[model samples]
Target: MVQMIFLFAILALMTIVLMEANTVSARDCLSGTFGGPCWAWSGEKCRRLCIEERHVSGHCSGGMKCWCEGC
Candidate 1:
């Protein structure tokens, strides 16, 4: 009897967590290369340039390119 109650409690908690997770807004995680020539592979530099010029979040991608989100 105790084990059954514990199992039900765990299941309820899992259901609540899943429901709450689904309610949150999803991000446009897909990023694409943007901006002009980027010779150096710098995350901070690329993010700064992207936010300065395009007004969006960005990161340094492979091949020393600046990839921006929602671009």
Candidate 2:
């Protein structure tokens, strides 16, 4: 039982470390465009954009350009 618990704890720690090391890549806002905005919630990542004029929210890494419409 103790060994099982220790194994679970180690597994949990490894999972956390893996998650923290993971990073999401930027998405394309406009077609033919290479870089755009990217959003990451938990371990998943997504690409989002705003039509017309609206406020958009997203997350990106360093040296990445974050684009949004409106204010």
TM-score of each: 0.38, 0.33
lDDT of 1: 0.57
Report the lDDT tens digits of candidate 1 across residue range 1-71. Answer: 99999999999988876764443234323233355654545667767766765646765433445655555
| lDDT over C-alpha atoms for residue 66 of model 1 | 60
Off by over 4 Å in 1: 1-41
lDDT of 1 at 15: 85
Cα lDDT of model 2 by residue, 1-71, tens digit: 99999999999988866664343334323212224443333112222433222334333433243433233
Top lDDT model: 1
* Total backbone collisions for each predicted model: 0, 0
Estimate the Cα RMSD of every predicted model relative to the unseen true structure: 11.0, 10.0
